[model samples]
Target: MAVSQHASVRKTVKEDLGAIVEMIQELADFEGMSDGPKLTIQDLLRDGGFDDGVLSNSVPLFHSFVLELTEQIRTGNKGKITSCSSNDEPLTRTTIIGYAICFYSYSTWQGKSFFLEDIYIKPNYRKRGYGELLFKTVAQHALENGCKRLDFHVLAWNPAKYFYNRMGAENLTESEQWEFTVCQGKKWMHLPKTIPSGSKPLKS
Candidate 1:
């Protein structure tokens, strides 16, 4: 069956963390990087605006949206879209099938930009336009937030690259003189000596 036309995308609730984490693990496994999903519910709770102590007046460090079907769209139940609240009570979204996670970043050349960390739809939910829906939602969010551009990385051999290109994604590394660098594992764990308390750098 195709995705229902009434699928709804909504901001994630605090209680959605468990389901989100499960989907994250599924995505990691799909990408053959099982180690990538190190996030925990507590991490989401602490860093995802659920804890008021960490809320920033500036833009949130990240945001997520979940795709779920309204009861009217489902086969039998006639449930309406329920608004998610900050309370610990879980959302009634048994129809949830996909999610998009995004963050904002600053580019010296272009000011603010949107970074899509991950977007995934369950295999059974693929080819129903849900992924595209999530993508367009993210693009709209970027424009609404005054972002100069939206960016994300794709696996070189993944067929999704063609889909992204069809969506007008630019190959920054090939067309622009941009280089991507990453530091992880031991390299990420090790720290260089701290700078002297009051040392000034010599002019080059």
Candidate 2:
């Protein structure tokens, strides 16, 4: 599956936010973690730090890249893929099949690094090299920005482990003594105060 011939990757625009949010929900559903997505369009816009055309770390928490089909791919009764007219403008009516969201961080020991927070492709569109293309796109940005490493997490049960390993990703658990940990689950929604101070959790 030659990825170049299928889809084009680009930075998402304001108009693409709704569809991107939908894809995020689809990913969550596939993982069987939750039903709807925890993030919202407004939240994305706020934390994404889209200021006067620059991604200032002080404002936005993450950056994203969207993969859109070049040809029309039916998503719903009315959803269809469209093209960007001027190359710089966002495509209208285009079906976004996948996306890669990342956030930059300092690794202390390794210097600069970027975490691939979320990468997902519509199930129907998987196995066509789209996933690899998305991964490479994010990696390209990481390198261009002087990042020493790119990190992300995958469920131990996920078959995608084979793909990651094939691409030279290391398994810290087996290769070293580092551990991966996260804070969520039972105590998440029941928190006494908002985690980000003024932000609201996604609607249940």
User: How well is each residue in 40-124 modelled by candidate 2, as lDDT tens digits?
Assistant: 8877766776543354447568889999986422333233333433333333345689998999998989999999988988988
- Worst window of 10 by summed lDDT in candidate 1: 72-81
Whole-model Cα lDDT of every candidate shown, in order: 0.78, 0.78
Candidate of highest lDDT: 1
Clashing pairs in 1: none
Each candidate's clash count:
0, 0
The per-residue C-alpha lDDT of model 1 at residue 28 equals 91
**Runs of candidate 1 exceeding 4 Å displacement:** 1-5, 54-59, 71-94, 194-204
